[model samples]
Target chain A: MINEGCRLMVVDDELIVCKRLKQILEKAGYDVTVFNNGEDAVKKLELESYDIIVTDLKMEGVDGMKILETAKRKNPDTRVIMITGFAETETAREAFRKGVFDFISKPVEIDTIKQVIIKAQKEISGSKT
Target chain B: MRLRIWHKMIIGMAIPSFIALLGVLLSYGYIDDVQKRHGYEQIADNINDHVLEVRQNENYFFHFKNGRFLDKLHKAILDLKNSVNKISSYTVEEIGKEDFALLQDAIRTYPPLINDLYDNYLEETNVTEKVRAEGRKLESFVAEKNRTSELTSSFILHLRLLEKNYMLFRNEKSFNALNSKLTEMKKLTPHCFECNPYIEAIHNLFETYKKSDALVAEIQLTGDRLEEITRRMAQRERQRIGSFLTKTKLLLAAALVLLSTLGPLFVYKTATYIVAPIIRLAEITKKISEGNMTLRAPLREHDETYFLATSFNTMLDKLQLTYNSLERSIELLNEKQAQLVDSEKRASIGLLVAGVAHELNNPLYNISLTVDAMKDELNELTEEKISEYIEDISSQSKRAHDIIDNLLDFARARKSTEMEKQNIVRIVKESFNLVANQMRINNIKLEQDLPDEPLFIKGNHSKLEQILVSILTNAIQAMKGNGTLRVSLRPDPESNRIVLKISDNGQGIPEEEIRNIFEPFFTTKPVGQGTGLGLSVCRSLVREHNGEIEVESKLGEGTTVTLKFPQYKENA
Candidate 1:
């Protein structure tokens, strides 16, 4: 049961996309926060610890790729799922190599995110144990 | 005649040698005739000298009355006779008819006339003895009778005077005076028995004297005629020699002229016939060896030169054939080398494209995830339009992912494993949908004429879609995003094929580059805008479906691409 209190963060350039993702993740019983841009997301990353980070791959400044890097540096155990309107194999590979939790594309499916969130919760608990 | 070179040479040398031999022979004959004429003249002069010697001996005998002179004259005459006989025999071959006749007459008349003069002198001696006997008888009778007879003594005196005149004078007048005195002495004789004896003796002496004088005059005339004939024979001999010399001169002149002119001419002609063709063939051989394969020896005569020229030309023909085949092989080798270089270049570009294509996948996946999330949230919305908007976004993201997959497939040059019998019209419509938005935004007019019946083809669905989309994208771009584009699909029953044509009214390819359009990496597009492999990849995909693609274009006018695929059969 992934309804146990888990802290999550979502980053994207599109406010609607970020808001929608945040809503879906909250309904799935995870404490989730959303950012419309990577600049605020990187500030959040320095102050707090998150169990999972979901960020868009492309952005205006301090892009989701940089946020992914900052999240992994602050806490190696943090799991990240990168989202983007346009997907690239190289950027996805780069995100994974930097210790991202997973990668997903836009027009995202709820079932797919649910599966990913469930998997991330198990991984975090497994690491604690 | 078809004379060979050797035959001509032989004749050329033979002619002059023959002429020279003939000239030599003719000169020999001319010299021989001159020698014979000289011999005849010497013989004739010797005969004249011998006759003159016989005449001088005869004159010595007549004037001296010596037996030794007569003997010498007879020997000289016999010697003259022997010379005349020798000359007559010599003239029998060399002299002409009239001269031979004169020599024969002179020989016959001279000996008989000289013998008749000797016979006349013997007759005169007998007549003198008879006359002297008669006179002695009369003188004895007159002394015994003691008769002082004046007539008898005067007759004896006349008889003695006539005998002296006959011996001293050769003229007719002196001989007539002697005869008249003898006649007067005869008339004075008495007609008695004693006078009859004296008259008979006187008549006998007168008859004998007249016969001897006539024979001597005939001999002298025959000797003069013999001398005249001998002189005429010598003159005829000189005339004959002169004519022979003139004839020989003409003959020698003709031989000289022929040797000088015709000999050289014949030699030159033969040399030209034999050697000129050989020289020409040598020149042509040199030209051919120097790489002028087109040259050949000129053939004119049907001689040895003709055979040589024909053979040379045959060799040239074979050489030209070999050279042409060698050239063709070199050209083919060069073409294969170029193809190898082109394929190597394509392989490198393919690797670069693969790298780029792999990087694109993540972005597409991100877009799909976002759309899926949005669609799931919108499921609770009551507004029908909001649900439709969410569905549209979802489908568009799926299309974008599909495009990236297609790019990866293209970069690796991979053919899809799954193929199906699909409607070609549906494929075209789906492909057109992908580019239709861009065309609309750019003000490009799109026209399509598809048959009502579904035309099916055997091909992978995604690959077929890729082919149509690639062609449509090119057409749209070529039209500068604002021009008429026509697309048509129809069954070409004649060929049992389905034909698809995509045409645009835009800047078309140049004529020179049209043939290179199918080569990988060949393109007219600016850098970064095209990978230059669009048409080449399109053609390869079409070929994989057992289809053919062809492009036609005119610069500044338009471009049309026609794709044909064999119709799928039920049994097949």
Candidate 2:
């Protein structure tokens, strides 16, 4: 209920992964956009602000790290979470250090993703008040 | 009986030696007989010579009318008789009784002739002595009467003159004159009785001498006949000795020839029987040494060679047995080696299985999360949202199923049903997914530099995926939780080949052991941690696709493996 009006973005090379994640988050009363590639998500990040950004670690052309960097640069207020098939790299740790909000490994649970977005929305509204 | 070599040798020598000995014995016997016969011949010859000498002596005694000649003749006849007896004794022993009869006849005739001659000689001596005594007595009477009566004395003187002329001449004229003178003397003797007695005595001596001479002639004739018989016996005995010698010589020669010819042949036969087997054994041994174990020595019966052949065949059998055992052992060794390779293959598949399991965990966990969320929020969800959630759930489950099927295919080693043109980059990406979770979990970094353009190759996609997965899994494991894994693909236009290289900055292999890294069961990982067949299986998989795999490594720095495949071209 606290995650209603949550602006969220999901990116993965597998369209199914992105779609499944988006559907689960949108059903939980959050605003969700799905991208099958990091490139489209990065292009959308340049024009819009979101409360949370979820992206896959590996993709064709652009990757999760690039999306994280673009989100942090365009809007310092945006919370970033990385979804990866790879869970055992310094990349996830480095993303965390660089102010990413959270890291999840695929195929991620919708509940966990929803919980993290809800938490991010509370932090944003709490900071605005 | 089984004949030993030494027995055969001894018999071989003994037979020839016996034959030679027999020849010698036969020669000795014949020669001895010849010697004895020769002795008999000598005796007979002596007897014949003595008869001739006796005859000559008789003639001389008659011709000379000397006492010395008569005495010599008597001694000669006695010697002749003794020699004849000696010949008879010798012939009796040497020649058989049938042959001895002639000698006996000679013996019997000789003694009688000799006795007759002796009797004749005694009579001649008696007559001569009587004539001389009577003449002397008449001489005394004539002397006595010459003084008393001149007629008596003159008649005695005339008789004496006639006797002296007859003794000196002894011819026919002398004989006639002596007869006339004797007649005149006989007429005158009527006048003188003393002179008549003397003249009558001389006439009596002449008659006795003629009878003695006839007996001598008969004795000579008997002696000649005896000599003829002895000569014939000697000649016949010599012929018999000659024939016996010839027979004995022929028998000896035949024996020698038989020994010389047959004895050596028998010895040679025995030698061949003994030695041929040994030679055959040697030949078999040579062949065995030359690696032909199938040959065997032939068995023989009842000889030393048979025993040798038996031993040889037994040894060959043992050798063959050992050889068969060795071959069986080698076959077992090959089977064990094959097992090792197969187990190593299973081990590598096991590694892939773990990777696949880990890979499936993500999608399965996603499915669980999505379904759980839908269950929790089902009452509030719209129809479109429910359909979307159900679709997502179904697709994620399908992903998990696909991973399992790939593993099943790899585990079964089933050939991919479909062969098609594939892009190398897509295959590499798919293989990486299986180990991507493991790689990330271990803090290993993977960097890929695949070509932008599709690198085409004709192969089964799943098998190619298996090859790449094996290589990546090895690289990840070698890094042991921390290193860089770089996969790069490029085309070589010059060779019309495509090269895929994987480099890892991990605990690189040592220089000496790097060459063995691709051999099954060769492991740098601790026991139970790695099967060590990853790289070997990778090479095999690559080769199945007409590719070559090579690795270059430096100790403590890094390892790079290059895989090359013939480029698939649309047109030649």
Q: How far is each candidate from the true structure, as Cα RMSD in Å? A: 18.2, 13.2
Q: What stretches of model 1 exceed 4 Å from their correct place?
A: A1-129, B1-3, B52-75, B87-91, B111-239, B276-324, B334-572
Clashing pairs in 2: A88-B440, A88-B441
Model 1: per-residue lDDT, tens digit, B203-237?
A: 55556555544544554454455555555556666
Q: lDDT tens digits, residues A9-121, model 2?
A: 88877665665566667767778898888788899999998878887776656778889899999998999888766565577678987788888776566767777776777
Q: Please list the C-alpha lDDT of all candidates, in the order they appear.
A: 0.70, 0.74
Candidate 1's displacement at residue B227, Å, is 5.6
TM-score of model 2's chain A: 0.89
In terms of DockQ, the best-performing candidate is: 2
Question: For every model in order, what is the iRMS?
Answer: 8.7, 4.3
Which portions of model 2 miss their true places by more than 4 Å? A1-9, A22-51, A58-78, A89-95, A125-129, B1-92, B97-101, B107-350, B362-402, B405-475, B479-506, B512-552, B556-572
